[model samples]
Target: MSLTPGLRFSRSAQYVLLSNVAVPYPARLPYANLRRRLNSSSRPRAQRPRGSPRTVLRRASTASETKPAHGPPAVSVPFDPKSPGSLSTPRDPIPPESTLNPPATTRPPPLDLPARGPDVSQFSYLFRLGKAYMQFYKAGVKAIFTNRRLLRSVAPPSGTASAGGALPTRAEVLLRARTRHDVSRLPVFGVLLLVCGEFTPLVVIAFPRLTPMTCRIPKQVEALRRSAAARREASFRRLAHLRAARGEKAAGAADGKLVAGHIARSLGLTSGWWDKAGLDSPFASSVADGAVAFLAQDDALIRSGGGVGGIEDAEVMLACEDRGMDVREKEVGELRKRLEKWVRETESSSEEDSKDKVKRLLLNHELLV
Candidate 1:
């Protein structure tokens, strides 16, 4: 013991000694501890059950919940077959005394005839309606020819007389204008009648512009007026935009040639009657000139005819329509007042005050404000 060597050695020698040594496993562990360790390490994990209590409660709550009602209220009203807006109402309802009886006529029966009630059947009604429409179409065609003849008779021989001749009477002008408008739409009306057949009335009601003025019922006329009012408002907005884009000074010039061009394009004077263009082209200027002349003539005619008061109701409506004014829901008296205002302003203004005149016609002047 007195001569025992210290355990410490040089680093290289200690590393060599440790590298050659072997560690032994413990062989004396207790059986209970070894068994417990093996059982715990080898045991399988327990899985959670499907549809647990919390999940079932959540699903039950959701299923028991009620949703609120949506959309319009459910109060039912009885349908009126006599109403003009009713789908079941006759499109062209004729009384028993009307002369347009299909049975009394010698013409052959329509190719498509409804088999129900002889007098009240769909085919009977449509046949009578067709006859009525044909009557109107025939009248319009006749008037067109008659007006053309009258106009030609009054027209001087080519190159023999000056371009200026006696102006047509107010009646002739009004008749010619109405007939031309109705006749021009005949082809389209015929096509719709052919294609739509029983449904033609519904189509015409929805698109009143497709039918001629002569064939339009009161309801269709009202619908058209409403649509015209919307279009007039749109034109006003477009004019405002144009005025903004061009300087205010240009828009308010004395001659108002630029504004005149825009007004002409809006009034359907451009080629194709739907083209949109500014005063950048010569064609626009020419169209504007034509528009101005037409308006001046109309003004002169109105003045010569004893102002707005002397014109008939139909003539008043036509004038309002031509000038892009809103004629919706207006009575004869109210329309006359509006027209009188325009005429009064125009009377005091010169021909060069075109912008103001057009503005008055369009109802876009300070009067609107």
Candidate 2:
């Protein structure tokens, strides 16, 4: 085969091109020159100055002059050899002590503002009243569940007779009595609450007796006691007037019936016992007899259980309240003392004297203290 310029044929019959005709290779270089070329090719080329050397030098001098002489004194920070970045990054300036810990400013004395008055708005009052009623309802429910056994075992107020063959303990009697009174009030109060809604407070205020012992507010309870005390004083005065009118015949059967009726009314035995017609009716006489029987039975039951002193503190207070005594502002100790006196006086009296003793005690309820 014919060969082209700068071309040769191998023994295998393959064409081998040593160099291109248009671009020739340079002559072989010396060892030193070859090494320098290799190094120059491997390294990055430096950028040339855009301006004259004098201008560049002038700029460098001006920059040096403008720079602070002592670059924020190199803060001697603890260097970690392992942290390579720490050596390159400039340290942040140290803050002054004043900035680190600012001085505490003196606060002005608090203004002597007048105390705020109680919230009297209808909505506010209603909200609080509802909360109180809810608490009262919850307490009543808990009491009912807790004393359900006792309630089941004892007869209600209307029955005035023990259900169980065994004579009930003082605690059982008190629980049964309180449960009956509270249960009676609960249904009516619940109806009022449902019907009246927010206006239930007004209804409760108008008829405080409708409120259960557990549901009565401190203010309402105090008011009720005060009113009851006044009524009790009036009842005593009426009894005195009746006795004076009867003169020497005050102890006679007719006079005694009249006295018993008055006693029943004073003790709140019946709802309409105060009506003149009801007072002298057969119903009133039966009610008076029942009241006397209930008192005598209760007195015996109390004596069987170690008298008034053996009763629980709560029961003593309840008993006092039941007997038309003013329990407001009175401690349990004071109540026990008064109740103990009444129980002892009744126990020591004869059958005839005991009836009179109960009447006197019931009329002058608070006077026992």
lDDT of 2 by residue, 1-369 (tens): 877654543622331143233333442223655876798899998897779999989888897454222111121232121221111112454222111111111001111222334757766665766765555444444444434433443224433543343444443444455566767777887788778764665678888888766556555766777766665566566667777886753444556676666666665565543543434445666777666655655676677655665554555665677666677778999888887777777774466666666766665534632
Question: After superposing candidate 1, which stretches have Cα over 4 Å from the reference?
Answer: 1-119, 153-168, 175-224, 242-250, 254-258, 265-285, 348-350, 353-356, 359-369
lDDT of 1 at 210: 62
Candidate 2 residue runs with Cα over 4 Å from true position = 1-129, 153-165, 249-254, 271-282, 348-356, 363-369
TM-score of 2: 0.54
- How many Å off is the CA of 78 in candidate 1? 39
The clash count of every prediction, one per candidate, is 0, 0
For model 1, residues 1-369, the per-residue Cα lDDT tens digits are 343355444655786566556422342234755876787789976665579899978887997463322111111122221222111112243222111111111111122223446458776777776665554444433434443443333323334442344454344344445555666876897787678764565678876766766556566667766655554455556667766786553355454555665565455454323334323345766766666566665666677655676555655666666665566667878777877776666664566574356554543543321
Clashing pairs in 1: none
Clashing residue pairs found in predicted model 2: none
Per-model lDDT: 0.51, 0.54
